[model samples]
Target: MIGAFCGSFDPLTLGHVDIIERASRLVDTLYVFVAVNSEKRSMYSLDQRLAWLEAACAGLPNVRCAVQNGLVVDACRKAGARVLFRGIRNGQDCAYEQNMAFMNGYLDPDVETVCLFTKPEYDLYSSSNVRELVKYHQDVAKFVPACVLKTLLEQEEMDENIN
Candidate 1:
């Protein structure tokens, strides 16, 4: 069974990696779909996000990274994925993902959404929070994966150099 895990992933967090690793084990192939949302402003570019995702999944042979510009269900359809993976951190996430799952099922009955709970250690980590911490010159090494942290630090140095 092929699974699709879709997210903006402006900066891939450790929580996201955990879900991807777990999801990869359950399916023959897991597509890490990076969503492109034009309305939302991202700290990292699409290319950067893809790179981070690739790095995060480098060791997982069954995981592949790709970009999606439209509905996640459409991406799943294109990838021939029957399962959609979602990582839920709290009740808020669960509620929002449940609605999305319902709508996705409506759009494609063949695709099923699977919600995975994040580990307690990673439940508090979010891309937005990590970005904010970086903005304030705070340490975020624990929140994000090493590859992401390295790229973020490099980007910060570049920004400092430009200024």
Candidate 2:
């Protein structure tokens, strides 16, 4: 079965990698769907996120990233994915995700959401934290994947040039 993992994936943290790796074990093929949400104001653009994702999963088989410009359910349908994979980090996340799952089900009953709890090792890591570290010029090599680090550096160069 094809599973769609949808997220903003601003910097593709290690936590994100862990979730995807676990998801891969459960599905035949996994499509990492990067969504564009204006409200979120991500540091990386859609193209940048996709590039980072591609680099992170470069050697991994049966895993690919794509830009899906719509609701999660619509994106799943467009990608021909049967299940949606989400990584829940804590109780607060669970409550929010449960509501979203129900709403998404209301929109598309055929598409199911499979929530996976984040590994304890990465329970505290999040995109928001990653962004803060990057903003402060802190070394985030440990928290983010290599590809994401490359993209972040490249974006810094672009920003410098624009200035």
The local distance difference test score of each candidate is: 0.93, 0.88
TM-score, per-candidate, Cα-based: 0.96, 0.91
**Candidate 2 TM-score to native:** 0.91
Q: Worst lDDT window (10 residues) for model 2?
A: 37-46
Top of the candidates by lDDT = 1
Q: What tens digits encode model 1's per-residue C-alpha lDDT throughout 1-163?
A: 9999989997889999999999999999999999987777988888999999998899999999999978999999999999999999999999999999999999999999999999999999998898889889888999999999898788889999999
> On a 0 to 100 scale, what is the lDDT of residue 89 in model 2?
96
Let me know the TM-score candidate 1 reaches against the reference structure: 0.96
Error of 1 at 6 (Å): 0.7
**Candidate 2 local lDDT, residue 34:** 86
Q: What is the C-alpha RMSD of each candidate to the true structure, in Å?
A: 1.1, 2.0
Candidate 1 global lDDT = 0.93
